[model samples]
Structure formats: C-alpha cells, structure tokens
Target: MSVAKLVDRENQENGGKDWIVEEFLAFSDDNRFDCSDVLFPQPYFELSNAFVSQDNKVSLKHLHKFLKKWYKDLAGVPWHDTHKADGGYYRYWSFEAACSVILLEINDDKELYDYLYYPKDLIAFYHSFNPTAGEENLLNKYNRIAIKAGEKAPQSGYWFTVASNNSRQYFNAGEILPEIKKQDWGEVYWQFEKEE
Candidate 1:
C-alpha cells in the first residue's frame, strides 16, 4: 500500500485522538511530500505521505514509534519502477526510495544511507530508459542531479556534475555544461565548476 493509505489506515485502526489525527493530517497534506504538485487537493492526500510527526518536541518519541514499524516496510522488496504501454505515469522507484529516506528519522545512519541511490546509479538508471531527450527530461535530470548523492554526503543541495565512468572529468546530467569541483576523495564540494 502507499504510505498515505498506510498512515490513514493506522490512524483509523487506532481510533481518533483529535490532536494526533489532526497532526497526521497536517503532515499528510504538507507540500514536502507532494510528489506531483500538478495533482492538487484530493490527489495530494492519497499518495507520497507518511506520518512521523516531525513537528517540535517529542519528535524522537514519535520517531521511535515509527522506527518500530518502518523496519517491516523496509524489509520488504521495494516497489520497483514499471512502465505502461499506454501514456500513463511512469514509475521511478529510485526517486521513491530517496523520498522515503528523506522523510525518515535517520535512526541507523547506515541503514538510512543504504536507502538513497548514488548519482551515477540514478543517472544510468534513467538514461537507460529515456526515449526522448526533451525539456521535461532535462528538468527531471536536473532535479535528480541535485539530490543524487553519495552515502556519506558532504552537504545537502544539488551538485550538477558527478564522476561518470570517466576519471577526474565529470559529466553534467544533460550534456549542457561541464562541472569540476575539488572532492577530497569523499569530502567538500561546491558546484559544477568550483574549488575551495
């Protein structure tokens, strides 16, 4: 089941506690998890949401509660990507996995680390499937390139270039630019082409 449905079902199973239910609704409606901003109102409420109650104090208490159940979900094989013969929505499992980690408690750093894919893996994954290299594809790759990262990531934003199969030379996601940065094997990075 989708995370939103699971959260809602659990809330129903627990009976209504006004505050708790309201908080869960608040999180479920939040823009952070809205994978498709285009689908407003109803669609936003049904998918891509999970309840961990990240607001203010007692977050860890809440995190512990979720960690208890998250393992069961994590242990299962991920919902892999699927393509439809007709022009329906394409499933991007790698991005979904990344989303799941970003919305978590970071309990076991190692386990959380395993949830996200490296830039190269994501690159190759998408590249293998792309049929038309168009504006949307560029935008998608641009968005992915920003979030795609290593396990022990340095900082938290987009870095346009990644070491493709080649050495010191890195490739931009859309072939529009060249990015060169100082990565001390596994530390400090600034931009497409900068060093410090």
Candidate 2:
C-alpha cells in the first residue's frame, strides 16, 4: 500500500523516473493508492524543476525562497506531528531538502546549515561514500543467476530484468517474479545481481 502511494507521489512529482517506483507499478496487482488527503505544496515541484535548468543562479534563488517558506510553515505541514504524544516516530523530516543539497552539491549554504529539518548527518553519511561503486562491486562479486518470470526466486536479494529500463528490484525467496507486459526483449527473465 505504501509502495503504491509512493509510486503515485513520484509519478505526480517527477513523472515516475525512479526505478523502485517503476518496479512496483510493473509487478503489483494493486497499484492504485489514494493520495487525496496528501498535501503537496506547489513550491516543492517548482524548486525541483529549477534544479534541472542550466541556470544555477535561478536554482539558488528558488532554493533560498523555498527554504524560507518551508521553515516558516514547518509546524503546519502535514508531516509535522512531533508535538503529539505518539508523534516521535512520525516526526517531520526534510527529505526533499536533503536530496536537493546532495544533488546540487551545495556544501557552503549557510542557510541550510541552520535549518532545523535539514538532515546534516544523513547528508554527511551519504557523501562519505560512493554507493554506486558499492553496487557495482556487489554485482561483480556475485554470479549472474537467471530465472524466468514465473519461477520463484531461489534466494532473496536484488535482481534486474534485461527487458525493461530501470527494472532492478528486490525479491524475497519463493516470491514469483513478474514479466513485462510489452515484452520488449522478447520474454522477460530476471538475473540475480546481489544479496540483501
């Protein structure tokens, strides 16, 4: 259910470019999730689009404006539930801001340094290592194990289908993999790449 909402959110936000979201939409029987209650500010999308533009100055201006507005309305946002007794686990976290900082490589932004929701430690942890290299290493270390779409996964780990773009996903042991509807590669087969 959560995966469905995530797919809807990403699809609305960025045309569903994320691989994980695409994978969920492809395999899940129930792919629809109600997001009518969700509150997505327009500025968030605008700020995201600004990053894709060639103008850094415009992007920075958008970032600054967004940060100011976001901080000003922090307590009013839907995810801001920290004041409630049972809200600790559901407390607001500025994931979007953290991602923006990382994507933009904005190391010297003083405003972000003081922002309460900015995940400095998380961003630092992300910057500490190259995760793509780690994934490549994992792929190289494991033997490529191929299985048909209807076959159950022999081991629980990450797998990729050569038939579709952004088809890499995780599967549990005994879970049946899915085939692409379009069959772009002439029958989908999943190839094992790594273990959880």
Candidate 3:
C-alpha cells in the first residue's frame, strides 16, 4: 500500500498518468472472491484503493470515514484464529489508516484523536521529525551523488555525508566509504559532493 502511494505521488509530481493506482484497482477487480466466507473482509480489499486513489482529497476523506468505523468493522474477522497459539498479543491497529493520514498530510481531523486504532504518537513523531524532508533537500542540492556507506569510492574526489555537518573529505579510489553515527539523523552515509 505504501509503495502504491509512493508511485502515485511520484506520478503526480511528474505529471504522469496514474497507471499504478489504476493497476491496483484492476488487480482488485480481477481477484474478487465469489463466496462470502473469505478470510479478509471486504473493507480490507478496499484499503489500497482508498489509500492510493488518484483523487487524494477524496481518498483521504473516505479514509477518515473508514477509520472512524475501523475497530467496529473488524468485529468478526478471523485474525485471532491464526494467532491463538500465541495468546493473540498482536495489536489490532489500523496502520494503513495512520499511514494514509501521514502521507495525505491530513492534520485537521480532531475526531481521529480518540480513535483507538489510529496511531496518534506515530503520526506526531512523523510530523515532528519529517525525516524525508531532509533527504529531499539533500537530493535537490546534490543530485550528482548517489554513493552510500561501505561502498568503495568510485573515483578519488571530495565526498560528504548527506545528514551530517561533517566537512567534505578527500577519498582515494577503491577506498571504503565511512559512515557517521548520529542519534537524531540515524546512519549518515557518504555521497560524492565535488571533484578533487
């Protein structure tokens, strides 16, 4: 579902046709089960469509409505049967709904504050940190570099890490790239920043 959403977003950013979302809708139509005794509920099948729909505003509205009734909708699901031996300790959270909320940038929904399935903390953390923003900024600034940690330097040049303030250091060809350890930024990897 996340991959489909990313593809949809990429297509939208590049002004391309929404073929990925269309393919997903088509796949769902092709895999329809005739019987009513299916393991996955009908709502489960509709999740991807609601998440990665071409019309994001409408899809987000539908997603908000669906999340309101998510817990009640899963009343008779056979999810517990498969995990009975493990004491059914798994959390029954609507991860997809939370992900949709984050991806759609829907922040004004006050009703979702109380939804049990809604991962409020996760959403808060994602909004607060916005890890992708830094990466996107770096990509825009240094589009030529694509090297990562542990990779041998393709050629002798000055390299820098994306998520770190470390100065660009010169590296010899065939030298292994080094990583910077930082708590806030996670693993900072080297990228080709400039020529010698």
Worst 10 residues of 1 by lDDT: 38-47
Query: How well does each candidate superpose onto the true structure, as a TM-score?
Result: 0.21, 0.45, 0.38
Question: After aligning candidate 1 to the native by TM-score, how far in Å is the CA of 21 from where it should be?
Answer: 20
Give per-residue CA lDDT, model 1, range 30-142, as digits (tens).
53221223222222222123333444224433333344444234343343222334455444333433233334422332332332231235434543565566866666554
Residue 122 in model 1: lDDT: 48
Name the lDDT value of residue 44 in candidate 2: 59
lDDT of 1: 0.36
Question: Which pairs clash inside model 3?
Answer: none
Please state the error at residue 141 of candidate 1 in Å: 22
The sequence of per-residue lDDT tens digits that candidate 3 reaches over residues 1-196 is 3344445453445222333234333343553222323234435544544655667666766766777667667767677344446675676677767766665567654556777677778877777775478788876775665566878999888988767675579999899888667678854567777675
Clashes of each: 1, 0, 0
| Global lDDT of model 3 | 0.62
Mark the regions of model 2 whose C-alpha exceeds 4 Å error after superposition: 1-41, 71-78, 130-196
Candidate 1 at 84: error in angstroms?
Answer: 34
Each model's lDDT comes to 0.36, 0.63, 0.62
lDDT of 2 by residue, 1-196 (tens): 4445444553466324543234324444444332212134544544554465566666666776666667455556555554555635554456677666666666655556666666778877776766588787776676477887888999999999978889999999999998677734665679998886
